[model samples]
Target chain A: MTALIAGAASTTFGKHDDLSARELFRDAAEAAIGLVSLTAVDIDAVYVGNFMGALTDDQGHMGALMADYLGIPDVPTATVESACASSGTAVSRAVDAIDAGQADVVLVGGVEMMYATGIAVITDALANAADNEYENEAGLTFPGIYALMAREYMNTYDVSEEDLAQVAVKNRRNGVSNPISQFQEEVTIEEVLEARPIAPPLGLFDCCPITDGASALIVVSPEFAANHGLSPDVRIAGRGQAGDTLALQDREDMGRTRAAERAAERAYTAAGIVPEDIDVCEVHDCFTIAELLAVESLGLCERGEGATLTTTGETAKEGRIPVNTSGGLIAKGHPVGATGVAQLVEIVKQLEGRHPNQVPDSAIGVTHNVGGSGASAVVHVLEVAG
Target chain B: MTASWYESFAAAVDREEPQYRRCAACGESGLPPRQTCPTCGEPEMIDAPLSMSATVVAATEIHVTTPKFEGEAPYTVVIAEFDENVRLTGQLSGNEDVRPGDGVTVGVERREDWPPVITFTPS
Candidate 1:
């Protein structure tokens, strides 16, 4: 009863000046549908993952918009919004329907059109993801929120800024081979350390850019995959979502993310695998420090030991556990709503052995997407068809 | 359910003593007060003066900010622990050189046409 991902596609992630969110979604949806043998008429359900479309585009009803744009208006469609985890939640919902015997073929898409507005507007829109009553009103920005975490992480672990900069360097290195990535050049740790400061201990390079793009996945039940001759190898083996206090100050420990741990625990339980079994991962690296937190939360490494992974080159593509081989949100770009689905697209590529920087024989992969300063999280485990 | 819980802190700050709500039942206290204690769901929460002394558990100098605080970039944000283990976030006053474990005192800075923002001055 597992939902199998048969096809996945993503648009070139960057500032798409000419395209709207629905247009970007349509492009990605068309490409995804083109990958499989199915057509728009065959999709039984459609879910769109989008964040701040109303603020950015003055549009709502994303699911209906996508349905009409795809010429499948008759299909049941709805949009899910959980900040950056929007599309990730949509994928989980699609899986739930399939698992409940509600649908066979389902289409999940995530899109964000951020460049339609200026940085100020985009920043305000993004801040809506946080607790507007306290955090935002207190003048805490997203960078500021994560900056506090980075400061605590550095102080608690006795790690230096240079240690975290290595994460940016590594992800940017991986981005060089990814044609669709926003930033396609390798960077040195020195450059990252010396970059202009966005938040103390976090340079401009330490943060992901404001990007506009879309990604898509075609999920089918095992029976449908087997009967249609679609590639059923990449199965959605596990899925989990966890919630936490909205405001960062309310958390018992700012240095660690309980939501990620909870979500990862549920995902691992469902997948019947441990962190050691994961060959590749596309984590929510909206900031460089997040990558460290994600690995530690997922039990891939011990707490406070995350900063050392990049220094030792273990998280690199050729290293022990290849992380963010798709350049992650750092280099690949983060279009908020589109990020979660993009993570899955990358994992599917890796598991299928067709990733741009393929991990040798990558059979198991994980995708971790965080929403609004770890207030919410969604984790998914995918396995290569045996 | 007030227009903003921050106004409570703002009003207290106008009197030169910042206050935070504490639940008698759960011993939980925080800023931007809630109707009931989030920890134990106790409705018997009362306003108590925040500790005059606190220590910074974390600090960061934000070099970038949102549009609302555009010109205020490169300011420091700190998470300080007050009495009763109540932790709150605020901007550090005097643009002081602060770090984790630094001692500070809570204060308020009023902004025209807006609720006063909270701050922590190095004690």
Candidate 2:
């Protein structure tokens, strides 16, 4: 009853200034549909994930719009939004529907048109994900929020900024190998430490860019995949979604993303596997420190040992765990809504042995995506199907 | 039920007083008061008092900000605590170098057209 991902693709995940959100989605959707033998008319359900379209692109009602662009306007479709986890939730819903015998040959797409409106407007739109009444009113931005988390963590863990900068150093290194990555050049730890400051203890290198892009996945039931003689590998093994307080202040522990921990626990349980079995991961590295927190939250390592992975180069593509091999959100560019689906796309590329930064012999992969300030989270486990 | 929570709290700040939502049953306290206890899910909570004396639990200086704080880059934000473990997230008015465990006092600006702006001034 598992939902198998037959085809996946993404438009280059950097600035797509010439493209509209729906246009970008169409490009990705068409590319994804082109990969499989099925046509757009074969898709029975469509779920599109989008955020800030109303503000950035002056567009709304993305689900129907995307379907219409794909020439399948009659399908049942809806837009899903859970902040940055929007597409993650969309894919989650698609998996459930196929698992429940509701439908087969579902199309899931995630897109964000951010570069159109410029940074100030985009920043404000991004803030819509936080608690407006409190966090936003207090002039706290996402960088500030994550910086606060990093500060507390550093204070308690006795970790230094150099240790933190290594995350950017590692991910940017991997970014150079990823064709869709926003940053193609490698950065030294010193350069990262000396980079322009976005928030104290977090240099500009530490944050993900405001990207404009879209990604897509064609998910079908196992029966449909088998019937069509589709690619036999890459099935959605497990998925879990969880939420926490919208405001960061309400959390008992500011340094820990409880939502990610819970979501990963559920995902791992559903997959019948442990963190150690994960051959690779595409985590929500919206920030450098985020990757550290993400690995810990995924239980890929112990609480404070993420720094070890970064410093020892274990999370690099050629290393043990090969985290963020697709350059992650930090380098791959986080088009908010598109991020979660794109993460899965990267995992599929890795599991299929064709990623730009392929990890050798990678069979099991995980995608961890979290919304603003660790409020909402979704985790998915994908593996080479038997 | 907590519709007037922000206004009441802002008004109290204007009167040189501040209050926070406290769950008497669970002894849990929080800010931007919720309709129910964040911890115990209780129906009602008391507007417990918040003191000027608070300690910084976490602090971050934002080198870039959103449009609301345009031309106000390089600002500090902190999570500070009052008595009863009540916490508030706000801007740091001064002492940009302050870090965790620093001494600070809450400062709130009440407004009619906008939400109250809260800050923590290093003590």
Clashes of each: 1, 0
Per-residue lDDT tens digits for candidate 2, residues A1-386, read: 38889889999988888878888999999999998998999999999989889998778899999999899999999999999999999999999889888888999989998877887898889999998767888899888889988988887786789888888888888889888888888888888889899888899888888998999999999888778787657899888889899988888788789999999999999999899999999999898888889999999889988888788888888888989988888777999989999999999999999998888888899999899989999999999988
Per-candidate local distance difference test: 0.87, 0.86
Q: Which candidate has the top score in DockQ? A: 2
Kindly list the per-residue Cα lDDT of model 1 for residues A1-386, writing each as its tens digit. 37899879999999899988889999999999998987899999999999999999999899999989999999989999999999999999999889988889999989999886987798889899998766776678888789888877777787888888889999999999998899999889889988998877788899998999999999999888788777666999898899988889888788888899999999999999999999999999888899999999989899999988878999999999999999999999999988999999999999888888999999999999999999999999999876
Per-candidate Cα RMSD to the true structure, in Å, reads 1.9, 1.8
Candidate 1 lDDT at B64 equals 66
Candidate 2's displacement at residue A103, Å, is 1.3
Clashing pairs in 1: A233-A385
Q: What are the models' TM-scores?
A: 0.96, 0.97
- Each candidate's DockQ: 0.66, 0.81
Q: What is the lDDT of residue B76 in candidate 1?
A: 82
How much is the lDDT of residue B90 in candidate 2?
Answer: 85
